[model samples]
Target: MNHQSDQYYIDKVLDGQVNMFSVLVERYQSLVYTVVYRMLKNKEQAEEVAQDTFVKAYKALDRYRGDAKFSTWLYTIAYRKSLDALKVNKRFVSSSDIKEIGEENIELVEDALSCLQAKERKQIILDSIMKLPEDEAAIITLYYFEEKSVKEIVEIVNLTADNVKIKLYRSRKKLYSILHISRNEW
Candidate 1:
């Protein structure tokens, strides 16, 4: 596997070396699919959206200004495309009735999950996140799994910095609440 800056491939693709685009896809395919899956919560739909994300990126590659990291730009496309998928499919679930998480923060959830095997813990965490609304799910995936900063998330989600913070905070609280319930269901 050769290592090269993302821009190196982007430059090559722009120079009419179309096959170079495969390198970018190979680099980001999993992450793009994961983010899409988290938001859509349906493997088939997420797969379509993820592929569309790459197609859109390829078509618009020339518009990329190199201001943000390539991954961030790709994520922005993934996030929006998933939102479009949700709109088209009309399956988005809202968490408005989910009563206050009350007393169950992520720390407590982590403690509860400590007994599970690592794989189970990770899947449980991902499942709990998938139960969230699309926006919050995307936020949590970017914050925890991808380690994207608030600024990066803001760019990806097209939200204000403060808005992203508020959503991230509420998403954490909501996530722990979901995990708390899951623990009890076991």
Candidate 2:
């Protein structure tokens, strides 16, 4: 079912058919988990944050004005909850550690990346993304994997459109650098 139909289930839940809420959870759980996992990088913590996101959304269902898509609203909650978890756990990676690799190394890595099969290439890309800072990783995941527009991302991450644009660009560059270096190490 599409996100538009999410409103129907939401209405049912609000009207006291709470079991209908499970449909919303089943529909959105993966999207929410992806956002949290990209930010948290911990399976256990990401799962917890994802559950919390759904609970929070369920509790705040009455306030959902439908001005935005349900996925967008759910994503915003997941994003905020992930940030809160990051703050509490202090799991953020330091920027200084993300060093630039040499041009020759980059080319070697690029060649290795291209040589891999599709599934392997995807795994390598996910690993590289996980190495990035939380905000950059979230921006890349939301923009590329989830196909969220810059405006939708802005609403989710509370960044300006220009900032999201810049982050998407920089995050791609960073991911390339990471993939290249990681491939070389193999």
Candidate 3:
């Protein structure tokens, strides 16, 4: 629930109450999955990577330095694992392919987006996110969905704070373009 509680669980697990590790997994699995899925965009691969992320965290548990939040440390593992998977799969989207939507259409698209049901809106956003290049999507997901600070994201993604900020900005523009185009089809 809180960092202190997370530390308590970590200490318990380190003390040989290994079952307590499940609590850590349960608390963060979905968060880790979201990050992986956003990058890989494959259900099976994402699930596999999520499992790997936990396994990695468990194996490296004793090395956790406590300088970062447990979630941040866990995310760092997830992020690296996802990148490793990406390297193996060689699946990548080009950011250059993300066209910039006209400024005039932004408001119109926002209005159309608002008219959709929440579930539909969320699905559209998720679908669009899947179209982004891996790094951009990860940046957007971490900054917006996971509510991670730029500094925290830097640790996870191995990017500078300014790079993360720029990616977040550009990713939003790309997403807006995707949404605007999708709105027109409705």
Best by lDDT: 1
The lDDT per prediction is 0.88, 0.85, 0.85
Q: Model 3 — which ten-residue stretch has the worst lDDT? A: 100-109
Model 2 per-residue lDDT tens digits across residues 1-186: 555498899999999999999999999899889889989999999999999999999999999999889999999999999999999987769875565432232334336655766876787677778878999999999988999999999998998999999998998988877766766665
lDDT of 1: 0.88
Model 3 stretches astray by more than 4 angstroms: 1-4, 95-111
lDDT for 133 (candidate 2):
92
The residue ranges of model 2 lying beyond 4 angstroms of the native Cα positions read 1-4, 96-111
The digit string of per-residue lDDT tens for model 1 on 107-140 reads 3444566666687678778877877888999999
Best by TM-score: 1
Which prediction has more favorable TM-score, 1 or 3? 1
The C-alpha local distance difference test score for the whole of candidate 2 amounts to: 0.85
lDDT by residue for model 3 (1-186), tens: 545488999999999999999999999999899999999989999999999999999999999999999899999999899999999988776755455322342334446766767876777787788889887888888888999999999998888889888898888987888877777755
Single out the weakest 10-residue window by summed lDDT for candidate 1: 99-108
Residue 20 miss distance in model 3 (angstroms):
0.4
Candidate with more favorable, higher TM-score: 2 or 3: 2
